[model samples]
Target: MSLLRAGIVGCGAIFPMHAASVAASGAARLVAVCDPDANKLESASQLYGCAGYDRLEEMLERERLDVLHLCTPHYLHPPQAILAAGCGIHVLTEKPMCIASADGEAMIEACRRHGVQLGVIFQNRYNPGARLIREALDDGSLGAIRGARCSVLWSRSDEYYAESGWRGTWSKEGGGVLINQSIHTLDLMRWFMDAEVSRVEAQLANRRHPGIEVEDTAEGLIAFDNGVNALFYVTTAYSHDAPVEIELHGEKGTAKLTADQAVVTYQDGTVISRDRLPQDAMDYGGGAKSYWGVSHFKQIQDFYRSVSRGEAPVIDGREALKTSRMIEAIYRAGRTREPVLL
Candidate 1:
């Protein structure tokens, strides 16, 4: 099949990764980039040799794009995705899906009505550690998961929020560290457990960054429908970023995961360990970070192939909505200091 034409919205820190992923996919070519900031748009356009637009609608109308990648802020995802679906363009958006569960559902409905594919970026799921844990779980080597725990100890300074107009705001960013930075780890936790969340009890705090309206720290207990529970703690209040750590306790044994490595021990004392294969140098763009994993291209390729075959991408809007809803429940539980039923 011919290469699918692609356009990316929001020329933010994450856009470079998306741009590189699209270019490396071999299934799609970058055609345009959209951003409200003229400087950002111009820079990306020049860098990628693609058209630039200050308005999303203008780009959608002017460019014959088969896929639209949403690299914008959390709040813009649902509306931007719905708009692209209305134009009959397949959408692949960055995570959290949207700020609210209702918006996520609407985005899913729009894509379904338009008969276009909708995929969400959860690159961590493609990490070597995540893949290994998932394989063991599926093969029954990990046995039944009895409990799990994950922590995201990353740092974000006051200047980090001061530099961006929307980063610290509740309305724009949806939430703080939990929604933006730790959501990927949360998604992986849920994916590894392979169960629906039944309840969430959470607490939110602004431990360090005072000016920001959103929390810089959060901790929670999530109960799955399958009689399993997981504990999670995420904070940007640390001195520096750390590799996220996740552990799963099962009937057979346990599995521990980090960004690039996994260690699994079976009941019979057999142990297996794996580390992520080195990534292509070309895939690391300006925004690329080691903690972000090097699998954006993998997901982009899968989305392109799914769109080409007229099938749903693995991380479709509905699949992503599960995490989105869980996030909303977490926020609610955090604020009310009560357990929320999902």
Candidate 2:
């Protein structure tokens, strides 16, 4: 089998993870890196031993890439991914796909029209704890889920926003905590529940961040088709970052998870606990430990395998749309102070 050629399109804090994953995966080879900053590009080219380009068009023209990772900013995803897809290259992007659903839909539609894969990065779903929950729920070991809660209480100092100029802005970084930090939790919640969200009621606030237009804190209730109402709360205003918490109550039992562990108990007096890999850099707002999670390698490898086999990735654009739509609903409900029906 031929190796799938891969190129990364950003040299930010998260770029190395993609490069490392490409090195780690047997299915792909890293061919190039791209960024607007010549300094960052120089560093990336040196680090990865690949060609670096200041222009995306130049990279596309020169590199025979089979896969392109959009490690770019939130606002830059659509156009870049669309361009990659137009060139018949599979596109994988970091979370939130885009700040808005319409843009995400456009990306999805374009990939569909071009017959290439479009994947979103929600690596948290690949965790052992999350997989345990999904397996139990799938195998009927969890019976029926009644409700659930997902919480992400993490801190983001003023410096965190100031350093990343696009962050905290509605148009660029999208919403603060909900979009930037907590979207993984949102994706995990939907995956664990395995149901469609029917309605949403939410409230958003920019209470603590000093210089941002987006909400720093957001809490909401999402209702599913089976009458399972779930609660989700996220904020970057906390004094210290905390591990995310997810719990689900079901007819037969309950499942609770944190960054390190997962526990599921059945009504028959049986309990199951699974050890999860340590949560790394992205867990605490991307400062010193940004490359912390091991799931990136797992997901990246899976993506290439899927592509090589002509199968959709586990977290395809359509799979991401479920969480993206819920995010839009939360924002809409929060701004209007009314329940938004999905």
Candidate 3:
């Protein structure tokens, strides 16, 4: 098959991973990159041997791209995605897809109208352990899932937030722990449970980070459509960062998965345990790290495949809207100090 031509926007911290993936993937080639910062664009251009532009319009005009990767700030996601879709370019956006559900819907609608594919980066779903667990739940190995818990206790210092102007702002990064850091685990939670949240009650605060306008910690109770309840706790203020852990309780047994391990215990004395392989680059300018270095690559490859085969991406724009809705509901719940129905 002919390689798909791809362009990347916002050559920030995550751009290298995407560039590397594109360079290594058989299905796509990194043709152009755009960033407002000249230094970032030059660096990416040097490293990836691709043309770089300081503006999206220039890049779009110069390159014949099959896919456009939006790696910009949280707020730029919707507009950039829509722009790409309008230009007849398929889009692969970073997670949290968009800050607002309305924005997500607009992007999806624009893509649909333009006949372009829209995919979001939820690479954790591509993990072997995640797949195995999902398959097991689908086959009723754990029976009816009744309850679940998701905890993402990670740390990001003040310096981390200071690295980018949009890191901790509500207008830029959207929200703190929930929208920026916890969205991955939150997406995983929704994926694993295979249910939409019916309602949520959340408490959020800027506990540790002093200058940030958004929450550094968030604790919430989520009720899913299947009558399963879940408790979500996310914080970037922990003194010692810990791995995210998820526990799912079912009618017949319970399954527990830490950042690196998965364990299942059945009611009939059957116990299974396996090491959960990391499927994405977890380290984003931090001491904490993850193993899935090629996750973005996997996502891009899958997109190229989908385009070639005329199939849908794993995390399409519509599927991503659910995550955005859940996020908005959580923030609303925090503000109202009461449960918000989704």
Clashes of each: 0, 4, 3
Note the residue pairs that clash in candidate 1.
none
lDDT of each: 0.91, 0.88, 0.85
Model 3 has a clash total of 3
Q: What is the TM-score of each candidate against the true structure?
A: 0.98, 0.95, 0.95
Q: Give candidate 1 regions above 4 Å deviation.
A: 279-281
Q: Which residue runs of candidate 2 sit more than 4 Å off their true CA positions? A: 277-291
User: Scored by Cα lDDT, where does model 1 land?
Assistant: 0.91
Root-mean-square deviation of each candidate, in angstroms?
1.2, 2.5, 2.4
Q: What is the lDDT of residue 191 in candidate 1?
A: 95
What lDDT tens digits, residue by residue, belong to model 1 across residues 1-342? 699999999998999889998888889999999999988988899999999999999999999899999999888998999999999999999987999899999999999999999999998787777888999999998789999999999999888999999998999999999899999889999998889999999999999988999999999999999999999999999988888899999999999997669999998999998887665334556656655556887888889999999999999988999998999999999999999997
Q: What TM-score, to 2 decimals, does candidate 1 have? A: 0.98
Instruction: Order candidates by lDDT, high to low.
Output: 1, 2, 3
TM-score computed on alpha carbons, candidate 2: 0.95
Clashing pairs in 2: 280-292, 281-289, 281-290, 281-292
**Which of the two candidates, 1 or 2, achieves a greater TM-score against the reference?**
1
